[model samples]
Target: MFNTIEHINKENRNWLKSFYFIHKLSFRTLWARKASWVGTFIFSCCLLILFPFGLGTEALQRADIQIGTFWIMNEFVAVLTISRIFSAEQECNGMDLILTSKLQKTSIIAGKISFTAFQIFTLQIPILLLWIIFYNINSNILVNLLNNLFFVSIFFNLGSASLGTLITCLTARSLAKEILLPMLFFPLQSGILLASVSLTIHIGNNSLLGAFSESAWWTILIAYPIIFSTLGILLSDLLLQE
Candidate 1:
């Protein structure tokens, strides 16, 4: 079903070829499940519209809810998309073929992370816009918010991909896959969410006081991607044990 690599150089050459193959497959598979992501997108938008009605329009209330809701929605989107990432391979019976292919596990992890971030970024774009529109946030802060989201998404997606990959691989053969993903994911993710939400609120309030200005939060933003992605790359090979 596959060609043998006759030379070391040829093997190296084909690794990237395999990576791109998986990369494109990952992106295409994400969009193929558009209904799932679309439902989350529409649901988030509705929640944004209804938040003010449910929580009152006071500035303090809006500020608190804006950052909290946006971050949760982003995290939720990551879970919704990423939880299914590995399951897609298992569901199609391609897990064995993929793990045994010419591609290195790190290459597979890189390809998967690239596409996962891409999907999350695309989904968050409209949600961000809706957040600004519905919350009456300052228009001038739009660029700032996007900049923050850019960094936060990188950190969040890295952690999400790591946890998602780990959990999915471990739970792929489990009878209660859905129940296990979130149970394991949210606990590992709480720190990232806390830091992201605080930083976002600081950006909105036009102040960098307290937790937002703390170096610890910045470290988390910088370290999360590096740590989680590195871990994912390292631990990704463990999937073969299953």
Candidate 2:
């Protein structure tokens, strides 16, 4: 019994080390490519700027319309980020090094998904602030709305990022991966997007408790990450074998 417990604890510690190693690798690689993140930040700002002109400023101020537009912009960002999963490694055969090491494949996929999700969430923060500035939200509701938006953004990004990581890995070796990535990604992600939008609209109008009370929306928001993250971890070894 004592040996079994020690073995399990050792395994847990190793898994965490592997997870952090992969995450750190991704961070350094992405940070080296400043153009990618800089371009994405510019793209996000441009979207926010042009959207009002297309929708007309008056319509853009309407809560539902603006919220929906913001989410759609995030969807685009998710596609761009997720499409690049495993890309850095592919360029340098870094993935081969990782596979050849004793690092856990499950930890590897989790780390990649987490990094992508965290990047998306961080990028969205400025966009969210810009959104508040652009729409000139009522000062009274500003804090409350921001709180709700933050909550939704966390799960929304996680769910999309989780599934996107899996699909991106699966198609990483394909000749037309760029084309295939978005095609496979958007359809899978649409349900989560809708749930996020709906929750945003609800919480914008009501309170956080009110949004959670709507069980269907809440279920999707909660379940999406759990379901897809599991699939990603389970299939990662098989997918990465290629």
Worst 10 residues of 1 by lDDT: 206-215
The per-candidate count of clashes, in order, stands at 0, 0
Q: Which residue pairs in candidate 1 have backbone atoms (N, alpha carbon, C) closer than 3 angstroms, thus clashing?
A: none
Model 2: residue 83 alpha-carbon error in angstroms: 1.3
The sequence of per-residue lDDT tens digits that candidate 1 reaches over residues 1-242 is 13553576677777788779887776555567676578778877777777667667884245556677777778778887787676666666666678777678777877777677767778888998877777777666667877877887777777677667666777777899889888988887777777777777777775543544556887876676678777777887786453
lDDT of 2 by residue, 164-229 (tens): 888888787789988888889888887788778887777556533233356787788878899999
How does each model score on lDDT?
Answer: 0.73, 0.82
| Candidate 2 off by > 4 Å | 205-213
In candidate 1 the C-alpha lDDT for residue 22 amounts to 81
lDDT of 1 at 67: 77
TM-score of each: 0.84, 0.93
Best by lDDT: 2
